[model samples]
Target: MANAIWHQWVGCEYRVLKTAKENIVSQRSASPVLSSYARLQRFILTALLCWTVFTPGAVQASEELHYALTVNVNFGQDLGQPLGSLFEVRDSQGEVVLGAGFASVYNTMLQGNRHELQLYLHGDRDEALEISSLPRPSPAMGTFITAYNGELLANAMNYGSPMVWDSASTTWREDTTAPRYYQTPVASGNLVFRPSQVEYQGRTIFASERTTALFFYGAGNLFAWEEGESDLSKAKVHAVPWTPDRDRADMDHAATLELATSSAFPYCYGVLDNEVLMVSNLGWLYGFDGEQWRLIQDNSGNVFQMYTMLNVYDRLLLGNFPTGGIYAWDGNTLEFVSAPLDYAHSGMFEAQTFALYGGDLYVGMWPWGELWRYSVLDNEWNLAARLFSHPERDSDLLTPYRSLLRTEFPSREYSSHSLGQRVYSLLPLSGSLYASTSARSGRDGRDIFHFLSQQELDQYGAVHRITAPTEASAQIRWTGEPTTFVLEVHSDSLRILQDGVE
Candidate 1:
């Protein structure tokens, strides 16, 4: 703690400059009386102009980026099957080689880095898959998703209880040595904050429950941590070399690193300021500085519940519960960024997911599947659109069609619960935004599809164009012959002021 310090300076600094208004008036005026009046007026106007331009309170209006909001694709219709949770896997070229769903994963055939849908095929629906270390030509299963009772996808990789999915055998093998981990659903009153992956000393490390796997490069050798003891200060900490390809008998003994922390199960993980950060379900923020873990920030138990955490401009932004507002920690205190978080149903509709597109934060809500945009520059939030991508038929046309039918038909049923939509996932693929929805009604019912592009955002509305005044002039006709005077704009400056005086 001796090395950490929070700096605070409440005062602002400003600068004052001397202008040449008197010199300009003397040079431009022919009569002394006119020159005197002109000089006074010019001096007053110059002072006001400078104040208007340099004042700290003067804020420039923010600009909006356009996006073409449209339904590019529908997964259910395309596959002729219902969809569940969706995940993305990238190839060696960094292109999406596969789109994995809870029920099945689709193989994306490519033509020079672009996916050619004609050659696509679907894989096992019930099988859960996680990408292997080297995701090239194809991705091997490194983990599996299991619903042990009521548990949801607790790990950041979106799986529970770490297990390796052997592609050849098509079976999930558990890591018997790792400590047991459980992530309760948010609706169940507890948050599941799991560490996804972090880059440490050039190697990628992912933690599932208490088990930590360190992967190396090339014909790389993998490693794992030993089962930690109950001691918070001196938990077991050692590393043993292990190879996944070798026989289970040849697997080396696990080593451990006695990381100090109060939170027994930590799920929320992020990297900030070159440090690996972890947030526990208990609301404690821990940072790892290459050597040991240190508790950097902590909120009272059950006081500050974080729904989603994101990194924007290198700083961590957390979507908090109850308030539904976004908060950022600036190495010291938390700064709240206000938005219209209040929906028809309060905290029930929390921001479950977040994505940064075109400098704005797109927040996807739970249960409702609504989308909201937070203007980073203006510090405001607005209802961008809805996730329920269904169109209603006009009664006038439907009435005639219904009468023309000889036999009775099944009419569209309307119910409150039946009309609900929930956004299960929000992904930014290529130049568009792909969203997956779980709805009971509408075209989006149980659909895993739709991509919104910049063109769609542009179609939403035109951005207001703002331009500086290009010309400045004055009139002079004291010598009988009419003369038009042109004022030449020179330089501009700004200063932050504490008070009226600089």
Candidate 2:
């Protein structure tokens, strides 16, 4: 048998109800929050995913069926996580693959930076391979890195300019020998390269200048320069105004837009049908063709600032900022669907990014810096932290600027110390989902070091990884009456049931 891992979340009471050759059940007690946990244990953990990533190469030798594994868990009432002890999951060589219990209620790293959420599929391959694409926004991933055309590409956050990871060595080589991607009238500061550019027709598109303007990357820059825009880099394949390719572009058929709103930044972009839908922070939706632009919906004054755009479920789902909800756009009509960011007393936030994995939609939430999973099979949204280890914020979690960051990070809405939090980017790399974050507060800016503290900085940037806890640390005290927990594995898939109720 191949080595396997199982993550059992917090639940009530325990006992081994059945044990047989075909069916084996394991029981453990649930513990309370760590001794230092401040939430008072009001919120117990719900569901967790099971894995199918192990022994992918060994299974399906006949291309029909070869193996199946099932593990069941039962818990007693009032199970708690009060051990307040730190532990690790180590490999045979003694390297810790996972560590948690840094002042947590569940002692699980559910509140940390990254997690490899299990996809329960019993097959010869990993299910993460099914995820095709995801938004790679620059905000969440302070130094977000991506891959394109088989080469590793990274942003300009650490390096002054865009960088490419040397497949040969540990060093990163500058993509453009020039110091920058753009040569401005003076200087364009530092441009965070959003590698996820959407391609339409022959034009590949991304936004810059605060997304107030859209830049097209193509063979020729067939557009007239917007008066204030800058020029492109030395490798001028990207078609934009004021670039070398401008000479090859037709001045008459220039790609220019006459948007309905005044100076609105395109914070969100989604591909619906064949049209690229651009939604501004102020709720103005527009559809763009190679030559023509059409205003889709004008919610300009409605204050429905949408931050994230996802083309999923045959529709464009816009993450509304103020309402902390989602707006569904089916090309013909656009309306509010549901508020899945059901965090503490909510006011305004940025539902920043979205990714699809294991037949579910996962959202990168902001101001609280959390990730939520929406299950299509259950028709419900569940707070599933597929990655990270921070203490769950209290229900009344709010900040100074209406609990939101300044519209601009350097904006003078609040002091420079509190820039707010974000799950920033839910990027799909290789065959798995990788995430990055924009923490609520930290030493982000070089000069603003004095504004932050060591405690805040410590919480900001630790890379956390979690695995199934060892049996020694699995036992806990009681918290409630007995419920149910079940794990069923077949030759094709794995299924889990919590609260012992199936």
Tens digit per residue, CA lDDT, model 1, 1-502: 0100111111122222333444434443432222222322222111101000111111111121110001111221111111121122222333222221111111000001001011001111221212112111111111112222221111112223444334356444555332233321111121121233322222333344554322111011122223344553432323223222222211234333344442233434444443444454455666554445567766755555555555443255665544556666555556776545544224334454564432345676644445676643334566666643333322232111223222322353323233234443443322223343433322321112223233321211111111111111111111222111111112221111112211
Quality of model 1 by C-alpha lDDT: 0.30
lDDT of each: 0.30, 0.37
Candidate maximizing lDDT? 2
Give the 10-residue window scoring lowest on summed lDDT in candidate 1.
107-116
**lDDT digits (tens) for residues 302-323 of candidate 2:** 7767666554334667676766
What ranges in model 2 sit over 4 Å off?
Answer: 1-141, 156-251, 260-262, 289-291, 343-345, 386-392, 400-417, 439-455, 458-502
